[model samples]
Target: MDDQPSLARRGPRHSTNLVGRSSEWLESCAFNDAPAPLHIWGVQEMNQGLFGMLDQAADLAEAGEAFHAYMMAMFGIDDEQRDVPSAGRQRFRSSFLRLIQGWSFDSNGPAGAVLKGWVESRFGVCPSFHKEIIDAVPGPAWEVYTEEKMSSQFHNNAIWVQLDLLFEFCQWAIRRFAFPGQSHLTLYRGINDVERHLIVERTDRREAVIRLNNLVSFSSDREVADCFGDRILTARVPLCKILFFPGLLPSHLLRGEREYLAVGGEFRVSVDYV
Candidate 1:
């Protein structure tokens, strides 16, 4: 904690631009808050068994293939290759997988901003960082992030709703099969330095609450996580927080480090200085 930036040094600037939503909504969505993970679309959607087809799959690989096919059908992506090229079909071709791939390449880029904006709209969790610190106040940083989001969504056919459904599918799959009885998974994130992280609240010498970006990557495998950085951030991440995981899709998709994409908020994490 001594090596970390003091809250006073990185406190909110208190802007009134109305660029982001309140953090209170984020707090309420935490796992400890008796969160309704599927509150967005509701259990009724899940009950319709859109993903019940997964039950017949023998393993993760097969399930992934089936899920992918389902997603393609859901968005009418196959229609893109058909006779007439309508505006809707072209837009439907842009997918959540493409969004994540774009983000993996550059988090500060346009795709990253769209992904972050999706989280902010759905979870009410403001992004803490873009290319620069997205301070609490409405300022240049917010404008930069907002501009990227707007531009990306404008040019890319606006797949925001698709991303929402993707998240819903992921959450449903996680609860139904990935970790059926588990409320949280112990996830790890590798980091170059502790100081680079936003430590919002210090609970003690060993623990602190850090405000994560609206969408951040973590790993279920400690060894895979350590390969990326000198330090490790360990947290008990809620199943609801995860947007996607390596096995959630085909091996060809979301490749690298066995990553898990999780929604960001203030999380109490323990840092390993190794």
Candidate 2:
């Protein structure tokens, strides 16, 4: 693997007026309690810079009107005033619900299928269909698809969900470990600085590979080498693979309990004190 940062770049930048308009829409809809169709649509537009065109409008109200018209066209709702139901509107609402409900942030989860299908259809470019091109080119088609999909608004939301879960795990770890008042902890996005540390790489939505550095402070060099069945002094510790459900975990091993902090009812870690 290349070992590059995994998370995608932040959403596109927008003018202050456009941003204010989005905020105003959100407040008007009172979408504070849960995810709603309007909220999701607005967020997707904002991320893709679709709202930037509103800057050409005379004022915020004009921009809002323009946006509403654009939305109506995009959703295939022809009438501006008619409240009557239509097939196009029903399709739009159903599709939006599926998009929201089937969004599993983890690539290995069930929602991945829905996300993949949506991306392929929306872009009209299927990675699996490009086998010939992929074989003839320098880069992998799957890789390209992965990159593009991860950068989409749907994937961005998934990343946000993972980050939220991670934040909760960190809080649990801090409370469980009972660290000293002055102890410092840091969270790295895709890499860590400590030479002697444990790395938990997310292999899928429910699986991760934990590699312990040979020089990790929690274990002696000899012990680390023994774990790998290697006589070399610098041999890397063998990876310990783990599988987990989203909100549940298997019981911790007796050995693990002595060495690490348990978090989120699933993840466990041992950090080197800086």
lDDT of 2 at 171: 30
Poorest 10 consecutive residues by lDDT, candidate 2: 236-245
- Largest TM-score belongs to which candidate? 1
* Models, CA RMSD each: 6.3, 19.0
As a TM-score, model 1 comes out at 0.77
lDDT of 2 by residue, 115-187 (tens): 4434233212222211112221235644554554454444433433222222232232233322323222221
Q: How many backbone clashes are present in model 1?
A: 1
True-structure Cα RMSD, model 2: 19.0
**On residues 141-260, what C-alpha lDDT tens digit does candidate 1 reach at each position?**
889988888774534544766676667668767866688878788888877767667677787786887766667888888887787687888888877778888778764445566778
Give the per-residue Cα lDDT of candidate 2 at 58: 56
Task: Estimate candidate 2's alpha-carbon lDDT, on a 0 to 1 scale.
Answer: 0.28
